[model samples]
Target: MRTRPSPRSRRHRRTRPRSAIRLTAGFLAAAALLVSACSSGNSTTSAGGRVEAALAELPRSTPSGLAPYYTQRLRWRDCGVPGFQCATMRAPLDYDRPDAGDVRLAVARKKATGKGKPLGSLLVNPGGPGGSAIGYLQQYAGVAYPAQVRARYDMVAVDPRGVARSEPVECLDGRQMDAYTQTDTTPDDAKERNALVAADRKFAESCGARSARLLRHVSTVEAARDMDILRAVLGDRRLNYVGASYGTFLGATYAGLFPARVGRMVLDGAMDPSLDARRLNLDQAAGFETAFRAFVKDCVRHSDCPLGGRGTTPAQAGDRLHAFFRKLDAHPIPADGRRLGEALATTGVIASMYDEGSWEQLREALTSAMKKKDGAGLLSLSDSYYERDADGGYSNLMMANAAVNCLDLPPAFSGPEDVQKALPAFEKASPVFGPGLAWATLNCTYWPVRATGEPHRIEAKGAAPIVVVGTVRDPATPYRWARSLAAQLSSARLLTYDGDGHTAYGRGSTCIDTAIDTYLLRGTPPPAGKRCS
Candidate 1:
């Protein structure tokens, strides 16, 4: 699960509310798998008009100090899954002082398979701020993208600095992370709150101790700059890309910094760059509420509904789920030596919200925990979100997620006192998940490095046309974010999917697939206000 920033101007640092992690995990997973399943591998016409125009508009000379970094060559070799080649590219650890040191980035690509002349390379990021783009490409995108697009454009991905296989930022060991995930996010007393604070401080201190030099330089701004260098290294005149969830933020930052080089870009499950940490958390809490209501409506229609019956209202269903959580908080269900408490149960529920297909699994998990006292189901879901392997090891997803997020915006709260003051508003947004999420915002307050980026708009004024896709009931990156982002970008086209789940494209929506495919293949975005259900 990735952390999300909040809104309201203040001196506090950004943290990932519990809700934010739930939402981001769902979308990040969906974005990686949904499109892969729907891609039709068949030849199609190429979109040739925009590339030339975009390339012609690029600046004649690279920035003087950055030329060497951008011009460096990559030595590709066969690695990971078959039909894929991997390479390592060197980027300055600090852009301001290129001679100081360097960070090695992991890059991978699958050559175009089309019969005609290739358009160029198309880069993809599956969000997380921590999610592995190389893993996503090798596992999904390279083989799943529409055969037409895959045939013409080489699909590429680079693990951002401080992310997976890119000098990753380390935090707690597996056992420690397991404990962290089980920590009580909603404190009932000062003691519990202090414990939470101590845990966060420990997490920050660990990262600082082990990754001191890289901590301050892992900001999203730095990652965006890295993308520019990757663009030049790949010999692409302009960037052609697909970014989802937090990846949308990275892609937008790139466009803002290099507007003239923007080519065909698609941002799904978009994040609004204009809001601060507090507002982002509150809005995301509300978004989860909207998705939960939708889930209840669907759940109660079936006879096996865990929360309520067919006659129960969504509000009543939410109350029942809340009651179940309270029960678990007091007496956690046993599962594989670990107990399923409110934290893990709530996470398990939130995990299912990202994709509708997970609803059945959630239902079974809830039933087992509520009726049979078996918590393995929900615990399994929580483990999946945390990327916990069967052998008990963890990926760097959570660490890099926190590293990038904490550096991108101010913390949502200064301390537990601030969280106490904000509880009512958060509860008002989501009675089921609000209080825990509000308290979860304290994670970044104790960070070792101060934030380097601030909340701002990204207009990308001179960029070519960009497509912004939003799901009406998206649990993580809300639909409103897509609307706001489209409004903020000078040349953005909004494509709405009046549906459930996080992102829209290739998630069983033929209408959405056609519109996005048209944009990618023909360089003609769907008309503004286009709606797909």
Candidate 2:
């Protein structure tokens, strides 16, 4: 499975890009980090909160003069990884006015090998307004998905505009990104807070300088429009999709925009479009806490847990981890050439929360950092989360993540003062992650482009049955979000995975995999409100 770090802005939005896509074996060895990192955290609100208000106010209609763009054909050719065919599709940069400009999107597909009759095309997006859908398909989904599902449907992916392989949005160089990632997210005082603000401003300014034109056009709404064009070009009457994390939001947006054209959709690790950035962040903070408690419960049951031993309370375990963070804040440990400071160490911990499979690695890393003063393991985990290759080259994941998130919603906080006022609430929500995540939300405050989208409900009233899956303790996209999104979509069937992890399908649950597989193969969704363990 591909693990993607939480999208840059939301911190833990999607799984890290799978290791199979990386050029180096060094990163591939750290593949667990990718899966763990993707489970970070996402800030979003409950879909039922403000969506009704927003939906009632907006008009529902397709924009004029878009028929030609949507109906255009694609000339596919072999490219990138073997067995994958690539194509580029044209979309209006400004959907409001078709002649303004064009945004080129990259698409890739792996044709089915199964003998069964084709079930049509299955578009898979491994979330990230910034994550590379093409990369995800080539590295993980094309081969890693159950052979049964891969056999009947052509697996396809389209990198959203401003994401990888498309017309990507550039912000900072490798060195610059290293500095940005290392920048202290938890401020100590006025000087530290000012430094945090300056870092955010400089990052925003750099994006503006390098991608002035594209920045304004990469909102979720526009990306959804692009999907429609891809669907028409692929000759599919309706969309067949499996969208994870933020991809859930994208899928929902498409359903809302074209309810009649909706097809079978499986939104795993769903996001609620109705929540504003602040509420999203706060809820995400709480989510991390929930996942952490789950981790603590498991950790304390083991003899090797660095945080606690058997009989230790979850709260006490949290305090122990917090103390370690404070120690790192005061004096970072050396890790290869870099240092394992509080920021990096926190990121490493957050990375492991995505999937329980990484908990042992996290425990080992913690032991080394606390006892041996060796920070290499944790640093490696942090590096994977940031998508830093062995040579120090960085992907556009973080830049695109920030770009898309900032454009999709208003800033979570207006200024440092506002964050200061909100800190107590954040801390109350998640004593361990609250302060740092709250500061991370400030990233969009100095964004160069104004947000074009707002919090709203996606009620795809006339759509086909869409399956929404939620992990009860998913760290990034909380389980409540699945409940909320399922409620918002008019034709949604809620599948509850009473388990720990970021998403459900293909993660080892026979119940989840079977239910989804049955739905895709037979066009019969599992009974609504179905529960699985």
Candidate 3:
């Protein structure tokens, strides 16, 4: 499945449906010139009570047979991205077999700029299961983050294994990816269905052919282990982190694996790890339906809405959009060398859903495509979603996304029959998005590596209270996930942003921002049931 937004802010925008998360900003890197912008645990505890839940003490000793990794020193050099320093750290390729081989991870940081000495490193991850932490660091977090927080904590990011700059997983070349993106997910005939099946198999086989070993090692658990080693190398007593979307899952995994090592942490756009692959896919499908409903509700108020007028119901608007997708299924819209088929156009629409900042652009793009018979605008958005450069190159975003997702959990569907069985539920969840997303789930059915993880709770017992932020209308990581995660974490405090878009923290809610700022700065999480709009 096409993972979130290719826009950089959300991770799992996919041509194929898969539950993946990544940083928000990566998607916009290639298409920004076109499509523009895009809490806590503990209920009932008073602010005083929360502060009393201080950062927990961590064990000083390293685990057995891994002293070399734990004690490995780093040599920082200029990252060539002014003001950021880069270094490489080594982690065991297989934690289960530390001596078999090792993988080198790229790390980058922006030192604290404030006057006195800094508190410690605050690690940041923009959760692409495939998103590049170092990329997010250099591009957004390291530079544009809050000044007050930056002054006290040295900002750090590490490219998880098999992501960008960290031996990224590569499958198809640019041309092949273009074809893959154009494949129809809502097939109308046996021929089209078989074609999608072939595409899915080819993609998995290509990834296996090119990145077999990396694929086997790129699970989130391995990445979490790498983070622990990074924390130790950074000389931090505990991990202070801000992980978004899938990053929340990563942070939660860290907390669960090493509870005593937990520190001040924020998981924005939290994903519930307790659900299996099928449930996550199903829930995400429903989440997109929710976002689309919100979009249609607002879209109808605008005069330029392509779907409907002021009095049109959201259901009616969805019906129109669904019909339009059906038309594209029969007759694709030409956009430069490539065409905007049902798949790409749908992806373009979903990309705009990540952040409402692009809603205006989506409106214009839709107006042109539906009214003027042009597809360039939507094509640009799709390209951005895939991180496809103008030069016809692709980032390993999709490849890494699939690699991690397939290994993180077993396939959501074992074959086309399974997809067919899930169709009704998927369609009911998101009439405009469900079928394609369900079919998208089929991409992993042909994966090479077996799953290394499974659905389970991450209690992080005795860990410091974590701030879990959720956007009620978040399309990718549904808000309910945040609630579930918060309830599961032993010391979690849930923070709600009753607004649109993906992650909540830096998206401009004063209530949300101030609450997180105070927590990251003073280690006092938001009080239970704190909701921001």
User: What lDDT score is found at residue 75 in candidate 2?
Assistant: 92
Ranking by lDDT: 3, 2, 1
Structural similarity to truth (TM-score) of each candidate: 0.90, 0.90, 0.90
Candidate 1 stretches greater than 4 Å from native: 1-60
The C-alpha lDDT values of all candidates are 0.76, 0.77, 0.77
Lowest lDDT sum, 10 consecutive residues, model 2, at 23-32
Off by over 4 Å in 2: 1-64
Worst lDDT window (10 residues) for model 1?
7-16
At residue 324, candidate 1 shows an lDDT of 91
| Root-mean-square deviation per candidate | 9.4, 7.0, 7.8
1-533: candidate 1 lDDT, tens digit per residue:
12322210000111111112223211121111011111222222313221111101124477677778888889999985888999999888987678888999999999997787788989988777787888777766787777888998999999989988999999899998878877788788988888878888888889889899899888777787788889999999999999877788888878876788989999988988666677778888888899899899889888888888888987898888889988887899897787899888888887777777678888999989988999999988787777788888988877877787777777778888998999999899998888877877776788898776555666777899999999999888889999988987889999999998777765778899899988888889999999999
